[model samples]
Target: MSRGAILLLAAFSGCLAAAPEATAQTNTGTAIEAGGFVNPLLPSGPDPWIVRDGSTYYYMNTQGNRLAIRKTQDITRLADAPEITVWTPPAAGPNAQSIWAPELHRIHGKWYIYYTAAASGHDDDAHRGIFVLENAGRDPTRGKWTDRGQLKTEHTGIDGTTFVYSGKRYFAYSAYVGPDSELAIVAMANPWTLQGKETIIARPDRAWERQGGRQILEGPEFLRAPNGKLYLTYSGSACWSDDYAIGLLSAPAGSDPLDATAWTKTPDPVIAKSPEQDVYAPGHNGFFTTPGDRETWIVYHANPGPGMQCTPKRSPRIQRVEWDREGRPVFAKPAGSALALPRPAGAP
Candidate 1:
């Protein structure tokens, strides 16, 4: 055999032997088939964020403060994998406590963690901002992360993510406006600062957006459709209500995503709470591409029963994205009615 091939095979075989316990777990999440759909793989936490790096998957969520990290070659095993507390905030500061929506990204040969945090027990104190954590180590899964403080923006923001297009970098975030909470976006010159100005991207115009007594359009997530349209998805309504769901907006690829005028909001929500299956508060999601780009999947959080109490009951769930002929995103609920439905592919 070739020397290079032999070395690579030896390394993989060594990992399999060393982590036999991990390899032994084959589709253990309430499913009859191995690697099949299983919803609510994680029966706790919310605002799920997942990053698939090669065959490995790293996952996290809005656990209030503590930043948890789970690494597994197979995402299906994440349900049982122990989450390590990779980051702890300072004793006191703007990001001292109440961290939320932490998304990990590998940028410029370094690991960058984007998240929102605020002072303890203070909602008004919450700026809904973005902060960076850098890891210089080659393997992001094992590195010392240095907190880079908050991103510079004129207003409060959250659900921050970085996207690279046309050899340029940009940041997208969600925020509130006026008395009602709304999701918006701003172009960023760098990871730590917002450039130009903020643009009101989405609001609670659709019925699903106003699911509960209040209205909301937060958790801005940007993705390009197969046909090359810029699509933005946001969580809507109050998380305290079962009516909480997700909204969608779209525009041309070259259009200014930061310009409110350039984008268009769908009259109806693309994904919302599934009342039929008793899956409520289905929003705040992350997207991932399957190996070989064969499929696109969604990773989000939901309340299996009802109500919006953010506790151990609100766990992370995932499903595959089924697109319509019109080139829009359509979300599906897990099949079955007895307990919860099966999880989507690639989730634990």
Candidate 2:
């Protein structure tokens, strides 16, 4: 792809307007007369992340040049939410180009955003590292986002996410190790600084992870199970290829997160391309709980067809995640755009 094409592909997940509501289901599994929504929540959104704070939901994704956040009470009406441009990079410097995967998190009564960016004129695969912004206010969209600077990792990194385990915080991200990208973890002394040497947790060793001749593992997200099991879900394979999919690595909740040996990788992908549904390259996901905390949902991005090549054609889609008898997550299959699923429980 040309440089212009590459930039377009990287920055296409922009904000969108609201669509009409669809049919929804109630807590009793009965269909409501009105008020549900369909897939492709937005016409274009990649690496989509969402978090619910009380009655509000904050949504973000890769906007390329700057960080923007959409806040709403009803996720089905996300397109109608007011977007705030919280941060803009310098005219020329590190973290001034290719801003992607912006995640909103709250810790210690403050808000923080973990995202990836690179210096100007650098290739997307090179020079990219994780950077953070801190906001003192309780509402992330209403506060000033201060630059906390780039995270100093041993190598270039991206898709940085944080989780608290055993009363301590840890940062997990994808870093380049030799020819392939691997998932690494380090202790966090605070929301912005990483302590101790990084531990390599997972790599692209399986055939599904090495598709398109690109050995890659990126976009690590943390999910905690009800049984106290901690799982790190990540995107594998070359994202530009339709073969891209999601894989899982798990460790007990009490286990040392920095110990690479404690984590076990799933042999196959939990979610992959479903051509019958017209959903391809489905990965780079974030998890959220419904208003009543009764349901779990996965928010991620996918292309409607094969060979979409990471452009605006790659749009955000969501589906309720189910658990098997063993309590392990079961991401059935990617739902087609035409599938009229029930709206999220407790969503107005």
Candidate 3:
């Protein structure tokens, strides 16, 4: 799609003026009373990661080359918020091709970003790895970012994310190991290096998986449950297939999360496409808390229609996360064919 069209779609997510105490009805048999957020917060692009720092929400996504950041205190305005070119690669290397899934993380009083960038013109060689950016400006919007090089790890990785448990830091990324594409993860000894060889933590072995001629799993986001278990939520099935959905893997707390052997995959998928909602390819998701810490949410992408051809069609979206009776993560279906979710909390 042309750059102009891409921007137009992105603007559609939240480009409307704030409606005053408006009410809307939906097929869900529920009424949105008013002052609630809408969906399809952004029109295009996939692999969305949002970070809520204090009262502000900063969002970034998969831009094939340059990094685009939207800063907003009131997330509902993210679609209308001006886009800023926060960081660009001065000299290209690992972070040049298909720059997919960029996430903002604040580590040790500094802003660190974990994104998947591959060698130019080589998508197969793509590794979702973590890279660091040091910002000196008191405000991220006013400061410049200095690229701190790439992190080293085994396997071709993408969707790099970091988690801290009990005082230890662990990095999680999605990669393929088998002859066919199967997603897995490994622990990092340090942010910049792999701890051990590597372990296959998750895979596409179920009937719901294996869409698009390949069984794939990616966009893994680690969430710690209230029960103290480490839940690694990832997208499975083919990106091009409407069957694409989210799944979960669980590892006990106080165990080695990096040790692939420690985690056990669930027998059934957790989140999948819902025809009733007309939502297809509802995966490649990240988790975050609202600004007021009132609720947890899932930020992901979906194709309004079936069959995923990477065009301006697939767009970023956000929804609130719910829990099952057993305290497992349960996500609802996409709102509808269009985007109507609330802006990220703290969006401008």
Candidate 4:
């Protein structure tokens, strides 16, 4: 995509946080509604991510210009949580603009945040890459965040997520190396360092990926299913289209992440625009296990309406992670804003 088109995807998610009162649930002028609470724990959230550390949940999305996080014990009431600005880039630098998909991870007893950013004056995929920040303090919001520089992969891209398989560190992200973005993986020396060649695992070669007039394979999130198998779920299609959805790729429990043949792609999208469920362009998801009973939950962003597309109107919604009888994963049509469901299994 061109720079102008890509800016539409990167810029809007940051601005939506300013005007969240568009929905009745956001008004919060009255009681917590009769039957249940609403989806979109927050008004504007794209590529929504959350990491559970002890009793607290740290949340983030595409902030566009700067990096920030919201802290809360109960993610269902995230609108009432405290937002903290953890790191701000310099006015002139490669890691200064179009910040997106900030993932807060506590790796090796230290807090590290991985996010994508473009150059100070550029907004296209060429100038964008993944960067990391380190905070030694136990409390991430209060600590000093030091810039750890970019994760130098073979190609520059966005939405980088890391995982440890077989006791070795690996990084997965969308590489903008071809006609469209493709999911790539590489070995990581540590939390902030990359030390090997990137292997292209999946591409936007399937029909379901060519939505909104563009083929996209971004937002690679690592998942370890209850069945002990491994999966890499990624957002597909153009974010600017209502067809934007999620696709799945699976590998063995203990397989080589750097080998392309180890991963198998699902022909169709696992989750997509469900008008009955009032979720449009549903993509860019993160997973977490509940505090008490360890029920897995998915936190992601979607448009309330189909016409909203990839703009700031995209808000965060969540649901439980379900598995099928065969041990494969299942992503049902999400419960819309009208349905008031119970909080996650162990939320306080």
Question: Which numbered prediction scores highest in lDDT against the true structure?
Answer: 2
> How many residue pairs of model 4 clash at the backbone?
0
State each model's CA lDDT, in order: 0.66, 0.81, 0.65, 0.80
- For model 1, residues 24-46, the per-residue Cα lDDT tens digits are 22334544454444456676767
Task: Sort all candidates by lDDT, best to worst.
Answer: 2, 4, 1, 3
Best by TM-score: 4
1-348: candidate 3 lDDT, tens digit per residue: 532233223211210111221223442223323444556677776777788888877888777666778877766557877778877764556666556678887776777667666564443543335566667565565577877777676666566778888777777776656533455555666555556555667667777776655566777888877667688888776576677778778778677775767777876666666566566777878888876776788788777777654445667777767555555665555666332444444443
What are the root-mean-square deviations of the candidates from the true structure over C-alphas?
A: 12.6, 5.3, 6.9, 5.6
Q: Using TM-score as the measure, name the better of candidate 1 and candidate 3.
A: 1
Q: Which is better, 2 or 4, measured by lDDT? A: 2
- TM-score, prediction 2: 0.90
Segments in model 3 whose C-alpha atoms lie over 4 Å from true places? 1-24, 27-33, 121-123, 126-130, 136-138, 337-348
The reply for model 2, stretches above 4 Å from the true place, is 1-33, 124-126
**TM of each candidate vs. truth:** 0.83, 0.90, 0.83, 0.91
TM-score of 1: 0.83
lDDT of 4 by residue, 163-208 (tens): 9878899999998876688999999998988987889999899887
